[model samples]
Target: MIRGVRGATTINQNTEKEIIQRTEELLLKMIDANAIVAEDVAQVLISVTNDITACFPAKALRNLDGWDYVPVMCTKEIAVPDSLPSCIRVMMTVNTEVAQKDVNHIYLYAAQSLRPDLSKS
Candidate 1:
């Protein structure tokens, strides 16, 4: 079976270091929560808010030791009026035996307010 794990996090600044750090943190939490391995990941789709332009979040995943071959992409989030800023969101598709309801969705930092019900805070 295939399932999608969703996660979101916020960075204090738009620097490449900040983007990579927060994105790596969120991806690690998602992997831990779902027991996901690099081989099982189908693709990772990352989107950052308009305010974030320093770098692509996918850079973090590629830098992971075993994730060199994992397919990942990064894009800009829709600029919805009055929406959260400096936010990075990810949807990771993976092949897994876990039931959809059992999958964990993570939201951290200021992004926690974006999905209070699913926030890991």
Candidate 2:
């Protein structure tokens, strides 16, 4: 079955280290939570808020996971007022036997503040 597994998190600061750290952590959790092996993943799309630019979150995933064949794209999220800055979000499509409800999306760092309600769900 093809399904989407979502995960998101944010950097508390506007530095490169914070961006890479948070993104790598979130991606790992998302994959682990759904028991998604790299071979099972179809594609990954990363959406980040406007405040961040130095590094792409997808690069962090590649360096960490060694998934060179899995396609990953990055885009800028719509800029909104009073929203979380330095936030990186991911939507992953995978071929999995797991149900949609069985998927556990991860939220960490400042991104936790963006969607506390979703996390609780």
What are the models' TM-scores? 0.97, 0.89
Off by more than 4 A, model 1 = none
Clash count list over all predictions: 0, 0
Q: What is the lDDT of candidate 1?
A: 0.93
Candidate 1 per-residue C-alpha lDDT over 1-121 given as tens digits, one digit per residue, 9 for 90 to 100: 9999999999998899999999999999999999999999999999999999998989999878899999899988889999999999999999999999889999999988988987757
Relative to the true structure, candidate 2 reaches a TM of 0.89
RMSD of 2: 1.8
Rate residue 8 of model 1 by lDDT: 96
Local distance difference test scores for all models: 0.93, 0.82
Candidate 2 lDDT over residue span 70-99, tens digit each: 999999999999888778999999998888
Q: What is candidate 2's local distance difference test score? A: 0.82
